[model samples]
Target chain A: MVAFDFISHGFIQKALIGGFFIAMLCSTLGVFLVLRNLSLIGDGLSHVTFGSVAMGLLFKLYPFYIAIPIVMVSAIGIMKLKEKTRLFSDTAIGIVSSLGIASGVFISSIAGGLNIDLFSYLFGNILAINWTEVLVSFFLSLFFIFLIIIFYQELLFITFDEESAQVSGINVKKINTMLYLMTALTVVLAMKAVGVLLVTALLILPPVTALQFSMGFKGTLFISCVIGVLSVTAGIILSFFMDFPTGATIVIINFLFFVLSLLFKKIF
Target chain B: MKETENVISMQNVYFSYNSAEVLSGVSFDLKKGAFLGIVGPNGSGKTTLIRLMLGFLKPQIGDIYLFGQPAFLFKDWHRIGYLPQKTSFSDNHFPAKVKEIVALGLLSKKRSPKRIFREDLRIIDKYLDLFGIIDLKEKFIGELSGGQRQRVLLAKAMVNEPELLILDEPTTALDPETRERFFDILKEINNKKAMTIIMITHDIGTIGRYASNMLYLDKRVIFFGTFESFCNSNDMTEYFGEFAQHLICHRHDTGDIYKKSYGRI
Candidate 1:
């Protein structure tokens, strides 16, 4: 039996847990994605989540129902588009991302749900963590963990050498599609934690921090998970004193880590 | 030269990038244990042809077969390895140890969650040893010199026990002595491992000295056959003029290459 504190209210506990796994999952993938120059996937997928949410609001359906499929399709489409084009991946992602954000706004305007509390979606609200959000975050994070572990080699290969990876029969296109799909799913679930605008911040910052000192793939993963968990935890604690949103705080924490890494690189 | 089964066959292949034609009407076959050297000027289709064979790019006008099967559908990629021209991206730092970089070759083989298995470790160790890179296993890739980096890239190429090894300018950065040692190791591998090599390079001296077969690309394939035929052709003389004469000269001193043939290479 353990003593309960103010933080032990089921919802607060759930938010913390939800933030923990979402941070871990997003940051892990984000580190590699950012390093690979694919940061726009996080940005684009988050907008797609916003689009899905808008659809849910307009049609009076559950946001998750609309968000999941919209995000997944956009994710898969980005992969195909990148594969078939001569354009660099970042350019493709940027184009697709602009379209995603544009569509979300267009949908919202057409549906006339102009008063939608997009604040919850833009900047994360740890206060809004519900039972369902926690469960979804847990399972999705677990699946992401499985994916990172299983397809770890394929992703590393594709990132390193797409041509050689394809020649080695790794299904480079499909694996990239799966990565985008998983990224979409993670972003939508993490919406309850970090919101849309700041989500990429959490994703990019943690991984960059980990990459600073880590040596290989395993080292990168370990350092990313540690950095991610610590940032979110510290963010939540800071939210108590600063009276600010938890997601914003975590991003600031992550940014600080990035700065620290750069300083360390410069100093010693 | 004989009608033995080919490892790679390209028929009338055409490829373009951004509407600029690269390889046009290119067709060739790689024998099971031949070192096919592709040499050309900067803008030639050497890299493009390799990409098409690797199935990373599709030919607009023709077909490519690997291991006697349609290349896109072929799944035995584990037996084929490639070393790209730019082996290290901006992200790859020196802190990545040689063993860690080499282990990436087995990524397609192992799908488990645990740390790399003993068998995987053994294979990596074997390639490291075979490449004479065992001592550098713990060294960071960034810390190593260019020749060392090139050696590490070769080890990465062979780490998966690939039967067909494709290299894009494998010795491009090495000094002349280092290049000789690198080719010697490649010669040894050709004999011992029976590996089929497809290489794209610009150094005529090294290519003339080391390669058994030649595929000369010039926006289109200019020639494809034994080094003797490619070097001594009247068409090659008309096509490359002075350069063709240079290739013959490069080979003249090394009749040792034509004479000292042993094992597979």
Candidate 2:
């Protein structure tokens, strides 16, 4: 009866669907990103998306469309800069991230200063989920999943041993660029569920928790997705009953699960 | 030997990093199944030479060929298996099974939605069996001993049944017994499977026993010839100084090195 009551609410239903899809996409990319030691790239790109979203809002254009291309290009740019300039990975990420937040602050200040519309993008308001946003989230999430599935083995090879992958004719540069693009896209789409600031947590926490179990790569991936989806589902329900912010609730739930996983790892 | 029979050929190959020259005028030709031990002191570009041959890095000057094709155009990479030096990024917390790591070799040969055929599994099993890691295939690779992890990495390299295998300081972390066992395995792969090997190491006394051809490199081809020639040549004394004969003869005497400069004893 309680489940039916919750499902009957349109906004709640849309949030649940959008959250699940975002969780799926982020968690899948999370596994490889975590393993490749590029987890911070997710954080950096999300901040970059924040700036793009602000610019789109300032121009009265669709934010997702504007954010998607800019974030993807920035992702590849960051990787190229790191390689060509020999900057440390974190140093590159830090440089891009500061530029992102500064641009967001500057644009938002000029465009009437953190309006309700911008606030939703900054901290996430799942209650604002509309039919069009839901559809966009679904397609983006599907695209991310399909891309990863198709290049699953190639990604694995490159992530585990890049030299061997290149030597074995895997076209590592192309695959890496594709992976960066997918990660950027996933970070942007995840903003609907967790807001730009917290999207990296959605991308990293579940996979980090899954690593506690010491399962094989496939198993780890499966468990990470499960953890991600389960956290969002539980957090949404709890938020509905307790009247809490949806995004923060979901992230806190994920953190709790990570702590629990650590306990299990230590005890077992 | 015919030019086509050379599995790897480098002529006057030079590589530099910024202003520093890592390799200069390096030249050698490895035959179809010859085991080449590339020996050099630290910072002498032994690893750089291997990277050049593997096409991981390009030579700034001269030319290199793999299986008769120019290094850049050599599209057939699965034919070569490589084990890099032990000093790599290792996260013991990462969850990768031994079998999964080995299967990466096969996966690297394919695109994804990879159909893991029975043949692939058979190849994986065959190499796992060879490395005596069949029991640990399901175990976490990170949890294994350094020796066991080395074998898993080797299994990954050999899973595709490569025509050429290259290892850089593979036995550096292994104990004496494990190191000897590893060499024995290399000998088996070299003799029985006829897989050509190019190993970069400082263990001259040990590699002297296995490598058919030896390249004593110090930023260049100090000597590149048969093991017998390497032992008898004056370059041996030139490279190792007064201890050259002692180092070479130590192999027959105790099969160990007394000098730390040549690598671990």
Candidate 3:
């Protein structure tokens, strides 16, 4: 009865709704990122978000609005750097990631050290999410879902064999850019639920856990989404009852699911 | 009229990577229903030439036309199929099924939204059966053996019934028996379907058995003519020396065994 009463609160209701969509958004994109060997991109972009957020704070601007364009450009820049230098993708990601964090720290020092607002953004405060963000997350999630559905075959083709896809006249450059931009948008939205530090966990863990089951591609995607939604919902409820930090609890739950999936593969 | 049309035409095409010249003043014309075997040593730009035709690389100097359109601007990709060299990138963990991989060949002909309909599945099944891998359609591609995977990839390339098929060193890693079987399939496709093919190979001895036209490339068009013409050419005799030329022309004479066994060629 106490749990039911806790769930009835308006803030808690908003967090659940918003976190659900965000989880869907992250997990869906995660499957492609992991298979394309760009799983670390979520982590890379979130670091850039941190730097952008610090800039926003210093300028008295809305951090979310500022983070979007900056992170998208940074993502494309990572890709271009890889192409021009022929560096490995991870090397490109690492270069951008370090630059973002180093600049973030530099800006933080200039702003007279970290503040409570920065801490909230860094660690996340999903329980404090308002109705506007909830609606934004919902609509954004739906738009991405629609895009994925239409481009599913194209994505699969390029993921399997990029050269052959190009030979088949699929615009490999456009598809890659679309993927990176969508990932940028997803990372920014997910940061609000899982925090900058733990955002990649949301993007990587569910798909990796689902991969352990050796299902087909479509089945793997479906299972990953289920695990993502389940963890977010369970983590939110458990955190409310136990007085735990919402973001960390969610990540821990995701980690727990991964462990269970590994064991499940071993035993049965 | 269609039979006389040049399926692929290259004129004085030159290509270089960085400062190193790979191909210089290379020229060729391939008519419809021609089976062209591109034979060359390592780094002789055979793969580069194929890439140029597929529009994967742009020629630095001259022009390439495919199905009568400029190679760079060619939009009718469904009319062409390509099998790239097998790489180490197709690891054991890729999660696509055989049918899914085969279905990708059909995607080139589709518009946006690219939905696979029931008719598409039927087409995939036809190709799978044609390649004798219909039973493995539901299995993951990573789990297949080397020959099996090669067959699946070939089926994928042919699923759309492309008029021109380009293969790059497709049999490099196969065993002798598997290589023979692969050539037999190619011969059958060339004869029965009358499909134009451009295959890159390192096997000078065996390439003459299947290729209607031989193109011996070494950074330039060293030789391009019919196999019989190559067998009799005094210039090729001097370029390859007597023994090496005999090794290539000898295979042409003995290829009759294959022709007799197959009976249809």
Candidate 4:
């Protein structure tokens, strides 16, 4: 009854709905990223989001709107640089990541201290998600899920054997670019539920947990999404009752799932 | 496609990475339905040459034509199957079943949102059985042994029924018995299906027994001719030294024969 009443509140309801979708999207994409050894792309892009949000604040623009394009374009640029330059992928990501955090601190300090609104964005506030954000997050998540499902085979082939895929005429470059863009978009949208710092945990942990038990590609994919959604929902409710921060709680729940999976693998 | 037409043609191809030249003044032509064995020592531009043929890498100064069209513009990739040098997955938790991996060959040729039709499933089954891996279809690829994994990848490449099959050091991970069986399968495919095959291997004797032609490469064209001519040519003596005949006749499976024949290669 208490859980029901808590969810009956409009903001809480919105958070639950949006949180579920974001979880599903992040974990689904995470499987591919993990398989391709590109898990740090999420971390790199989320840090880029920090700079964009700060710039938006200083310019007196809606930070959400400003962060979206800036984060996405920066994500594409980082990926391109990684591919083209002599720097390794980790080095490229490190460069972008440090630049992002440094610029964000500089801009926010120039404007003033990290205010309440900016702090909320940094750490996340599930209860603060309005209906517009909820609707947009829902549809975008749905569209990305649909795209992933339809392209599972090609994506799997590319991830599994990139050289063979290129020889077989699967435009590897185009597919890679599309994946990077979608990852950036998901990181930006998932901000309200997990914030910039913890969004990568959402992207990486569920897939890592699911990989412990899954025997095949399809099994890993659906199972990852399932684990993600369950963790997010459970985290939201538990945080409400336990009076903990929702974002951190969700990440901790995901971490717990990963630990449990490790134990389960060892035992079985 | 005339029977005598060149399926792959490389004319004075030159390739370099940064400042280092990998292939300089390399030239060769593979005829239709011919089994061309590409043999070379390590770091001899064997893989790089194949990459150029597949259009994965562009040559700095040469022309490469596939089926009479330039390699860059020849878009009918469904007619070609490629198995790369590295069969090992970087990720330990690679989650793909044998059947799913085989099905990727056909899926790579299709448009997005492609469905696995009943016919496609039948084809997958046919190739799995052909590779004697039908019972292992549901097994995860990561769980399989090295030989079994190679068979699964071979099935994946054959599922599309490509006219040209290219394998790079395919027997690297296989046991001797499995390697023999693999060579037999390739020979059978080449003879029965009349498929053109280009294979890269370190085992010259084994490949020479099955391959119709040979290309001995080391950053340039050392020799390109029929296996019989390769055996008789003075170029063989110049390249492999006095043990050229021993290298051709002695199976590497016997202890240290290949190493003794090629000394520090």
DockQ for each candidate?
A: 0.44, 0.53, 0.57, 0.58
List all candidate RMSDs to the true structure: 3.7, 3.6, 2.8, 3.7
Compose the digit string of candidate 4's lDDT tens values, residues A64-131: 89989988888878778877885766788788888888888888899896877778778887767888
lDDT of 2 by residue, B97-188 (tens): 88878888776467556646767888899889987889998899889998888888888888888999989888876788878778888888
Ranking the candidates on lDDT from highest down gives: 3, 4, 2, 1
Mind giving the per-residue lDDT tens digits that candidate 3 earns over A123-201? 8878888898899989988998898888999898888888888888798899899999999998888888888999999
Best by lDDT: 3
Scored against the true structure, residue A139 in model 4 reaches a CA lDDT of: 92
lDDT per residue (tens digit) for residues A43-148 in model 2? 8998999899999999999998899999988998888988889897788888888888889999999997988888889877766678887887789878777777
* Residues B35-99, model 3: lDDT tens digits: 99998889999989998998878999999999888888888899888899853235465778999
Predicted candidate 4 versus true structure: per-residue lDDT over B54-136, tens digit per residue: 88789999999988888877788888998998852567678888888888889656876766788898999998887788999
Position B96, candidate 3: lDDT: 83
Tens digits of lDDT, candidate 1, B1-265 = 2223899988988888779998889888888888888988888988887877877778888999988887766777777888988742456542357887788776655444424677787888888887678999887776777788788778888887788889988887787776777788887787788899988877665556677888778988888887767656888788779675665546535436644543122
Model 1 Cα displacement at B23 (Å)? 2.8
Error of 1 at B59 (Å): 2.7
Q: List, in order, the clash count of every candidate structure.
A: 1, 0, 0, 0
Off by over 4 Å in 2: B1-3, B86-89, B108-113, B248-252, B255-265
DockQ, candidate no. 2: 0.53
Poorest 10 consecutive residues by lDDT, candidate 4 chain B: B256-265
